[model samples]
Target chain A: MTTTEAPAPVRTAPGGPPAAVRAVRRWGFLLRRLGFYAAAAAAAIVLNFLLPRLMPGDPSSAIVEELQRVSGQQVPPETLESIRAIFGDPDQNLGEQFLAYLGQLARFDLGVSVVNFPVPVSELVLQALPWTLLLVGTTTVLAFVLGTGLGVIAGWKAGSRLDSILTPLTAFLSSVPYFWVALLALWVFGFVLGWFPLSGGYDANLAEGFNLPFLASVMHYGALPAATIVFSAFGGWLLGMRNMTVTTVREDYVLLAQAKGLSRGRVILRYAARNAMLPSFTGFAMALGGVIGGALLTETVFSYPGIGYLLFESLNKRDYPMMQGVFLIVTLATLLANLLADSLYVVLDPRIREQG
Target chain B: MVTQIMSDTDHDDAGTTAARGADGDVLRVTGLTVEYVTDGDPVRACADVTFTLRRGEILGVAGESGSGKSTLITALTRLQRPPAVTTAGSIVFQPRDGGAAVDLVTASPRALRALRWTSLSIVLQSAMDALNPVMRLGAQFADALRTHDRSLGNDAAWARAAELLATVGISGDRARSYPHELSGGMRQRASIALALACGPELVVMDEPTTAVDVVMQRQILAQVLRLRRTLGFAVVFVTHDLSLLLELADRIAIMYAGRIVELGTASELYDDPRHPYTRGLRDSFPPLRAPLRRLTGIPGTPPDLRRPPSGCPFHPRCAARFEGCDTHLPELVTKGGHAVACRLHDPTQRPQPAPGTSTGGAR
Candidate 1:
């Protein structure tokens, strides 16, 4: 490189403040994206406000009626109005109610739940959040890691025995619905073999603090349900990643890496797999976001105490506030996950970087 | 000197060896044949191709697509993978340090590993695709350096990479940017810089300038020549464009249907090509400074190597084909450092196409 004579050279000068310009453009891109997400969030909240009214029954009315029947006394009309207000009155003018709902949202008050009267919807979501995060979140990540790793190998060695066996196996497993997977695992492991407990997030015998026994019980009982969701979703990640890896293997960079005399391992790791893993990384982030909503069927089958189980219970009781609260959380979390992935992808792929 | 004789197959005892660097021949390729084994018959991508790349010389390979220009380079570097089998020939590389000539066709994996990047390297065609997208330019350069020389520190490797980039007239922190951040010309130049990172004695380039614009291409070629003069490394440049080669190359090899039809010094082949295919190829490039001659595209497609025409492979498209051209094959005959495989230049052949006649009245 030092040998060039520089004869007849036409040197283009580096422009001033190009770096600063690039940074400004990147920041602009981020601001624009934030604005777009804000609109999405607003739309989602408005939908959340309207969706609870469409539920078949009302939680406040059911609770009030049950109370009156049990006590053998009619509830006062003023008290009835206050109970209705707590769960949102569907009879109110739609436009005015939406504005009022937005006003209440601004104050960080999600209103008290009628089903669990006097308990705020926010506290309910908070209580269930960690369990869902632990069970579903961990499983989703495990599935992605296991699937993507296998996928890289399969795609790298497309016609090998590993690919031939795993491709169809994973494809078949992917077709099994969540309920079926949970039910089948429950029947075999819990009922037939009795090697695992049938249902519940923790052992009925243990106390509910942070002791080792209770923690062990949570995982022990959570295992079957988690496996159901993870195994069912695992195959899709594997197939998607395998297909991506196969395509990426043919990319010119992989060939270039080989031409540079890098070892096969370096070529596969640095060139083939790194590029192939981009789509999988984005998929994993999106999955993580959505998993916050909880795996409904798996949770329901296992009677697990996650957000999905709470959603099911609230829906069964026609608990409008609880349903609305859970739905809003799910929507917001999913949106946030997608946005984070998009930003990270921009970081990973320079082709889309700093091009505001 | 155990004189190397390249027979029909690449695996035939690798022929022989000699004091290869004595006459400045950095690479001696003889009877190299690479075949693609399809379901039916094996297609010959490169067939019995023989040539020598001298020290510090730019040997340009000019041919249309499917003319085996790329395959020839792939064979020379042992980069040909399965389905594209090297059926014949030997590529004898004379080590720059005056060590015994190593036959690349027979070099063990460990030996090849050690020799690569140090003595031999390659620049792929597409600059954008050549660099790893996920990796920063500095890291990619570091990767190339660390692969062969593991003892080199990161800072040293990065400094060397930055130095290389500077020689290509890129004097900035652009090495820290990804391939996409750099312009096409810059990326190509970076690739060139990487090829020179280990100070290889010979660099094989597969259309290095084809991906960049014409202006950039000229600049890169000029830089390559100047670099070659200073670094004293031989280059085997392959491209479909002949005009660039005519201007930049010291010597040229014209391939037709997997075979080198003519090999000569750049000016000799440009002015007085004896092979009809070579003449057609030369005419195809619209001469820039000379009198304006209408550019005539070659009349026919390249012959299918799976079932190639017998005798002379270029006979179907040759404008000056004699009767013997369709019946007898002509071996490359050397005269005054120029070689042409055609009856017109074959002193032993009789009744050649009548002198000055327009090829059997075909016009």
Candidate 2:
């Protein structure tokens, strides 16, 4: 029985903008995000150039001392000059050399490592990257999925024993550092039990190939370090998400969802969990971008052939070019992660998009 | 009760308002009480409230903030959760299609779920936050329908949602828009549409237009009244705005403290109010059509439910309070046909004049 009454006043017109204007606004929003990232990336590159200079020791002198240690003779001045050129000119002022380095960076050249002699810094970084990505990346993803899933259940059923027990237990685990946990795992499962290998990325007999046997051994040797990373990181995600979900459950929209006669499961998933998980998603994205950096001490304790372990080796030998290479990768990775999170937040919350 | 309500009909403004719909009671709430068990002490939010909703009748619940109108509505719907506990009461809700009456106070979750959005639905206080911001308005409507009736497929559910949106005068194309995309007025209308999607026999709205502009508020109420006429559903509309209720409600109930002190037909309550609290409520709203008059607010704070006063809850503010009013608890008793819970109307009792005779029509 619909009546032909006067039409309802369109107080706020339904559509806000024309299709073409809206499209332009969307593109402008994307450009703003990218612009922010571009500025941050430049700052990070400048910081990378200045950080090594902050160190007390000279970059070239370390190379000379190492040469003396290997050959049991003091290196000649001519030899030192040649070696300095390979790293970068030690004679030039810091400003000129920085300009030279920036020019070389633009050309995608990281120069030869002072310690590795003829090996390009790029080659050393590339060789160490896959190990870090495979180990740290897999563990981070596993922890996020597992932790967020458990957190959703725990927060929804907050007063239950599972919530009471899991919240504290995760808190305690998260307080301990990754390396300390790795060492503890080694003590219990490696040293005391002798159930797994103590060090290295793979079995000595296995060649580094994509063959099934070699890959299986790589995972086998990588297990302890991966577990250590996951064990420590998952707790933060779990706790953060648990608190978020608990707060989100009280939101009016979630209550509205329940009033709609939706099952508790759907209300928690669609309303509570989705909103709660936004902050956690940023953490996950950052972790993903830093995947190439690897868990530093976890890799060191296991002597795995990851970037973290390689950084440790380079640090000891005073490998200047290699250090710059790895630091630059880390800087770029962090900047990219921040950019990803910015875009991600806009997508997750339309309210933010409107404000922007 | 009939005798008590009828006594005040001499001054009743218009005759044919809510009195015509006093037939079969669709809901009977007897001795319904709800309390908040907070840390410091238990606060009685709504106490011993009793009312009946006739089929297709509109009931307006009026009170100031902290007066428990919202609590009573939430409790009636079995939506009160801890720490707001339903301490004592029985709410008998009968399905319009003639199923056995269900006690909402003791109904199982499954039973409540089945009743919500199908037999009875609610339009919450704030429409802005009541909607799922991430989902499209149509998607939310479809979700409500589909969740209740799983046999309906996605396409059918969507079509039903579009139709419901149209019923509220919102275009079908706006279905894809999110809540934030719509203005405040449209969002409120969308919430109304969501409540009506299932064709509920009763709809409970808690201050639905409080956040809108004054002009939009009147427009929304007009739209709602028109819809109710065609759809034939009962309403329990709660607001702190008594003027809005006078224009919109069929029956108006004035609450003081946690208890409803006066309940009558709109004209009887407006023109022949007997309870001091109801008079205070009526005087607070300036009559738009009447000549401009000085308006003074109710003088004192409402009794704290945690430690309520010994006698009549409104004695501290009651202009016509008597000696016995400070010591004797007044029961809601019928004087003629109107119901007033004030000591002035306590029959067999005080020789004090009721507000109708004592205060005249206007104090």
Candidate 3:
């Protein structure tokens, strides 16, 4: 029994703009976000250029000292000058040096790695970058999904057996140091059991391509390191999500949803978990940005040929160009990840869209 | 024992405006009791609440903060959460489609799920919180509508949602707005509209207009009355404000501590309240248009439910308490159209009063 008569309409604000026009307003918000990211990137780039130059001691001598320790070889004067040339002359006017740095950056020329002499810093970065991104990026996402899903179940049934088991177990696991866990995993699974590869990103003999054999080999070798990282990381997400879900489930809207006669699954997922995931979503974005820096100790323990391993080696040998290049990539990746988070938030919460 | 109050003729007369179908009663709640089970003693929040709501009647439950009015509502709606359990009760609901009446207290979860929204719905207080802040108004409505009847496609569900919004005087287009986007008054109205989405026969409203301004409260009450007129749904309105209920409720039930001390027609309760507690409540609200009089609000706080007072729960605060009142619990005694749970009106407590000599009401 529905009424057909027209209702007396209340307070029409000239009917809000059509969908297309509203969509453009959202773009205005996105454009503002873009402007913020651009300025942040510019600031980071300037710091990338200035930080190495402002470092104590000559870059060439630091390399020479490391080289002598490694190879027991003395660098000739000519070789020293060539190394200094790669560093763009420490005494050059600050403006001129900055311009030269910007010009080199524009062409993606990060100069040459001192330790891997004659090899470009960009090339070394590119080689290590993919390994780090693939391993760490995929594991981060997997941990987030698995953790959040479990958290929803645990929090929804807070006093049940599953909740009791998961809560304390994850809490203890997350509190343990990451490197300690990684080392333990390596020793137990790799050294003792011999169930997985002890070190490296993939089998060295397999050609690195899109083929299934190569991909399988990579995963096989990457498994222990990936598992360790995920194990240590997922706990934090689970605990955070569990706490948030506990609070969100008590919200009046969730109760209202239940009273609406919606299914339990719908109440948990759409009404409870959806809102609870907001803070966790932001944390996940930050974790993703950290992935570019690589799982340092995990990679070191595995000798995984990722960015973290490369960074460690470069630092040990005082490879200034390689260090500079890696730092810049980390900074840029963090900024981009934050930008992605801001954009995704607009999609997830309509409240943010209005502000944007 | 639970007391079934209200004269049959008066109840039928008050409810006749929109009563339909063969059976006059839509809900029959008998010996309904609710308790808060804590670490220590379990506190009885509602003790032996018995009342029958007729089709298309507004039964207003009025009480102070701790008087179990809200508990009674939650128990009726079967929405009481952990620690608050319906220990004993039978919420017998007769469905609109002439189906068998089901006792909600023992209804299976699957059965309750089927009955919810279709036969029973609730409009909660604090509309800002009751409606999901993140979801668009239409989507929430669509969710409720589609879940009950799977035949309606997404488009059809959305169209119905817009129609529901329209009935509340919210433009159909405004259904796209989130709960946070609407004015407080509008959000409450939207919640009211959402409750009516499935055309529920009974709507249990728990202080639905408490969060809005006075003007909005009046508008919302007027809207509720208007909607009930067309839709013919019964309402059990629970609030602390008796004055508001006087204007809205066909019948008012005044609760003291955990028991309903008096239940009668609004005019009867207001003009000639039989129970001392009900009189205290009526005197608490100064008449709006009438000249101001010194208000003698209730003297004492409601007793702690964990260790309630012996005998009559209201005797400690009651001015008219006699010797037997503190020693023995009083049953809600009905005489004519009014019912009062007081020894003063208990016919067995004293020699039977001659006809028309009672303290309140014309017999």
TM-scores of the models, in the given order?
Answer: 0.89, 0.88, 0.90
User: What TM-score, to 2 decimals, does candidate 3 have?
Assistant: 0.90
Top candidate, metric TM-score: 3
Instruction: Provide all candidates' interface root-mean-square deviations.
Output: 4.0, 2.6, 3.1
Candidate order by lDDT, decreasing, is 3, 1, 2
Ranking by TM-score: 3, 1, 2
lDDT per residue (tens digit) for residues A1-356 in model 2: 56776543334465644556556756677788899889988888777666656667675666667666766767677556544543445568877767766776776667556577556677888888888888988998999998998899898878789999999999998998766788999888888998778998899898778899998998889888888888888898899899999988877788778778888788888889998998899888888888878778888999989899888888988776678788888889777877877787777876566444
TM-score of chain B of 1: 0.92
DockQ scores of all models, one per candidate: 0.35, 0.37, 0.41
Clashes of each: 5, 13, 0
| Candidate 3's DockQ | 0.41
Task: For model 2, report DockQ.
Answer: 0.37
Give the CA lDDT, 0 to 100, for residue A213 in model 1.
96
Evaluated at residue B248, the lDDT of candidate 2 is 90
Model 3's number of clashes is: 0
The CAPRI quality class of candidate 1 comes to acceptable
Q: Write the per-residue lDDT of candidate 2 for residues B93-124, one digit (tens) a residue.
A: 77776576777887878888888888788888
Poorest 10 consecutive residues by lDDT, candidate 3 chain A: A7-16
Model 2: lDDT of residue B250? 87
Find the candidate with the highest DockQ and give its number.
Answer: 3
lDDT (Cα, tens digit) per residue for candidate 1, span B150-244:
89999998988889999998864777777766778988999999899889999999999988889999999999999998999999999989889
Error of 3 at A238 (Å): 1.3
